[model samples]
Target: MIRRLLPLLLPAFLIAAAPASMADVQLKDARAEAQAKALMETLRCLVCQGQSIADSDADMARDMRSLVRQRIAAGETPEQVRGWLVERYGDYVSYDPPFSGATAALWFTPLLLLVGGIAVARLSFRRRRG
Candidate 1:
């Protein structure tokens, strides 16, 4: 039993000993800070449910925050930075996914369902009355 557990624990120890490649991000200018904050609010933390990267403390979120600062410091526009993250992590990382053909169903499904339910209710009431 000890031998079997050793293999599993070995990997955990190695991972624990690995260095975390994180940066201490401090946006030098107000413009960069503002842009980073706005963009962070729109980015969802992949490791967290219903939490924006800006509000998350997960390692992934910290790395993502650093990446956002780096991109902004490199003079990328807010839209470009968002696009870069989307390209890396896909649409799931975006809180406000773009209104494109693929996302139309997501955008309109709730409204469509509401209308369909109202229509069904009205038809049911009419049938019962007649």
Candidate 2:
């Protein structure tokens, strides 16, 4: 019984352990490929949250990588591709979102929070000392 199951189990194990398929197909031009890769690194992987599309293995990231490569191969500039993605997915998709009225809060919130935190800490320390 064990011998009979061994073959089936072996294939299953191999399949399960196999790495995920490559996300982006290489562009014909090396320069285009490099541009796609750089742009991918700037785009966040929605599924993986912290990883860039270039580094993520999630399905969404894979699709994003393919899209970037396809657009770049079609003669779109990296900025154009990035703009399209930002329009489609919103500013959250890019690691470095452009500053604008819509994104002002995103760019300033951290600085505001740090200042607020420092003020509160200073007050607390003063109160404790007095």
Candidate 3:
């Protein structure tokens, strides 16, 4: 009975002891860590949908985290690093992508929808009152 339970308990213990993900690693310096953390927050994890690279544990997120630190360590400014990533992966990698011809709709669609919705609501209310 004891040996049978030992095997089951060992697996559970190992699983519990294991780190959540390899992305648990961080930069040694406080400033670099903070800077990388901030920059990573601006980036989305392509593999994890809604999660930032800083928060996601997916393999791509891990690589992004590493790259952020590497660029920062190499004396690249935060904006420069962000631009490099965007140039490499396109605006989609950044949570708040820039406005461009290709992404013009993304920039204006929400305001357009809000205006349309208000117009419809106003028409409905006026018709009801009349």
On TM-score, the leading prediction is 2
RMSD of each: 6.4, 7.2, 7.7
Q: Which ten residues in a row have the lowest lDDT in candidate 3?
A: 15-24
Clashes of each: 0, 0, 0
Give, for candidate 1, the lowest lDDT window spanning 10 residues. Answer: 16-25
- Looking at model 1, residue 27 earns an lDDT score of 84
In lDDT terms, how accurate is model 3?
Answer: 0.85
Per-residue alpha-carbon lDDT of model 3 for 48-121, expressed as tens digits? 97999888978788877878887787889889999999999889899899888978887899999999999999
Better of 2 and 3 by TM-score: 2
Off by over 4 Å in 3: 1-22
Candidate 1 structure quality by residue, lDDT tens digits, 32-78: 88899899989999999589988998888878888888889889999
Give residue 104's lDDT in candidate 2 (0 to 100).
98
Q: If candidate 3 were superposed on the true structure by all CA atoms, what would the RMSD be?
A: 7.7
- Stretches of candidate 2 above 4 Å error? 1-22
* Candidate scoring better on TM-score of 1 and 3: 3
Tens digits of per-residue lDDT for model 2, 1-130: 9999999899887764432343455878999999999999899998888999999988888878878887888899999999999999999999898899999998999999999999999999999999
Positional deviation of 58 in candidate 2, in angstroms? 1.2
Assess each prediction's global lDDT (C-alpha) against the native.
Answer: 0.85, 0.87, 0.85
